[model samples]
Target chain A: MRRFATLALALLALGAGPRSGFETMTPELQAMQRDDFANPGMLWVAEGEALFQRQGCTGCHTPAQMVGVAARYPVFDAGRDGPIDLAGRIAQCREQRQGAAPLPTESPEALALAAYVANQSRGLPLAPDPDPRLDPARRQGEALFRERRGQLNLSCAQCHDDNAGRRLAGSAIPEGHANGYPLYRLEWQGLGSLRRRLRSCMVGVRSEPFPPDAPEYLALEAYLAMRARGLVVETPAIRP
Target chain B: MRAACAALLLWAAPVLAQPAAFQVVGDTIPASLTGTPGDAARGRAIVTTRQRGLCLLCHSGPFPEEPFQGDLAPSLAGAGARLTKGQLRLRLVDGRRLNPATLMPAYYSTEGLVRVGRAWQGRTVLSAEEIEDVVAFLVTLQE
Candidate 1:
């Protein structure tokens, strides 16, 4: 009986906290993520760097100036009146500064730019802006994360929070951190944004996914950034 | 007195039967799922196919033909000896009542959900007949 109690307590402790998806990956996958040449996600980062030059973004801001910029995204934008992620910010820059039409969300160019920008902040700890003004959106995101929905009657927390490290259909359930975006997934065989991954989760749970730039997604991103407070960025990550 | 009690229980069975919809009672479902007996063959097809039940996404079972099987949920190798038919029905109907945070999708029941896709609104993952079919197949797993 005493042994059983101790085991139960240990299990409870494991279930109570958050963990990086990196920790859950196999050694080979970890090595793949660590090596820039071998990581499939690097293809997108390379394309994004090229796109950045072609778009004339380098004329004003050098790559060095953009480094660590992604660590502070999903920040409150007064003009947009909500939190905007790096993808949204890239779209904003295209329209406002470059006098170019905003690229469609998840378009190759948008994904590339987002990937390039995120890669700049690679290795830096995620530190989304903590302004008090963004609290309401963050709270909404928290609620969305916990709210049960879809035909499954499940919340994101159901798997990511309670079942992190547990297997789900042969895939390990990570703590649902957004430290990686513009990540390359083996399942997708290409790069995808945070919203794209979120939409996939929604569909997996048989729920309706919001549009790419929906406020709900932004709120969710804000919440994820806050949740993954200290985790290092893993842009262009490889995952099964 | 014992005979009278037995008679009363039989007489009250139908009256107590929850109308079509499932009614969860604690950890076990105290009632049988359907009026008709389940067909194991039909149940097997539903459980194995991705278009219908998609049970293989999170469950591994005795089906050797299917190439990929999940290890997320417990294997259904000896499920017959493990749980009663009524209990299986409860899990199929709404597993949330058993473990509120379970990832198993409710094959039936449509209530208190949000952001449901337009194409799937008001539709349970599996129909009542399909639920019975799957349950029938699961109850046959003795190995």
Candidate 2:
């Protein structure tokens, strides 16, 4: 029954179809197609590349090691015993390897850098590598995904999975993957980080958002990252 | 003796002509803004100019000359008669005091601002003098 429900939901998402009319007519859409190479976010990506170079990111994540690397992220970390999404992984690197202070969860630089790195795997299938080390984290993430909260009394799956394409307050909920983050949100008036987007979901769920770098968030990210494996990356993609 | 008499005359001559200080207390009004009426020309300038009051940052108003103002706040054209002067004072003194969710910065309340090097620090954007100026101007905005 559960499998039948899942199949039905997936079909509904694909059938509900793309946003009609003004979303295509919007200036943002026009800009995305016409000038992606020179877009502000892309420019931020270049800056991130420079930061990575200057910060010696090539040491552990060598150039060859990074090809198709983003597709495997939000993987389970044995140390964390849960899912660790790309953002969580990056935070760990900054803490353990770079010896730099944790970048602010919502800062422009962090979002831009994350988007830049993620964009490397654009159009590639998400393929999170499984390891026994990640089972605990994935379980934690799955639990959080199923938990209900907010005045709406809804779970993450209620809208993102069950009603993926259904309209809620004039906006359609997408597949709810972290793939395209840190995408730009027009509502935020700037680029938003993945953790920030996660925080937004928590608020939508009416749950008091946990702080960025929280173990629960990391675990949830890990799970979504794995689920999104085989999906293409679309960093800095625009969302309502 | 002559100087003293002149000072007394100046103090007593025209109490009615001066603008009164508008006062408010946390979403409630202990006194109405019955004091010095504001100047419309000045209030218009305050709302329109970036260096002055800059009310357009949060509130929308009919500035036919400038259309690129903030969209977060409601339009404020003809705000005077629409809102009681006391209500206006409360809104200005501290919008958060009225609606905790408002992004409208408290123009008057200044208890614990940690950031430094910003204008309107330790004070409302519009001082008592400017508040009256804006109120007086808004009162004239009625259609």
Candidate topping TM-score: 1
lDDT of 1 by residue, A1-240 (tens): 243245346756877434678888889989999999999888888889999999999988899998888998888899977788888888888889999988887988888888998899999998879787788888898888988887556788877876677655445678888888888877677888888778777776667888755689888888888777678888987776
Model 2 interface RMSD, in angstroms? 23.1
Estimate TM-scores for all models. 0.82, 0.54
- Extract clashing residue pairs from model 1: none
- Window of ten residues with lowest summed lDDT in model 1 chain A: A1-10
Give residue A137's error in model 1 in angstroms: 1.5
Chain B structural similarity as TM-score, candidate 1: 0.80
Residue A136's C-alpha lDDT in candidate 2? 70
Residue-by-residue lDDT tens digits, candidate 2, A1-240:
243246447757878422322233358664763367734567667777786777778767765556576788766566855566666677779989889898776566666567768878766777776776776777777777876643223467766675554433224456677766666665666777767766666554324667655788767777777655545666656655
Report residue A134 deviation for candidate 2 (angstroms): 1.9
Tell me, per candidate, how large a share of the native contacts it keeps.
0.56, 0.00
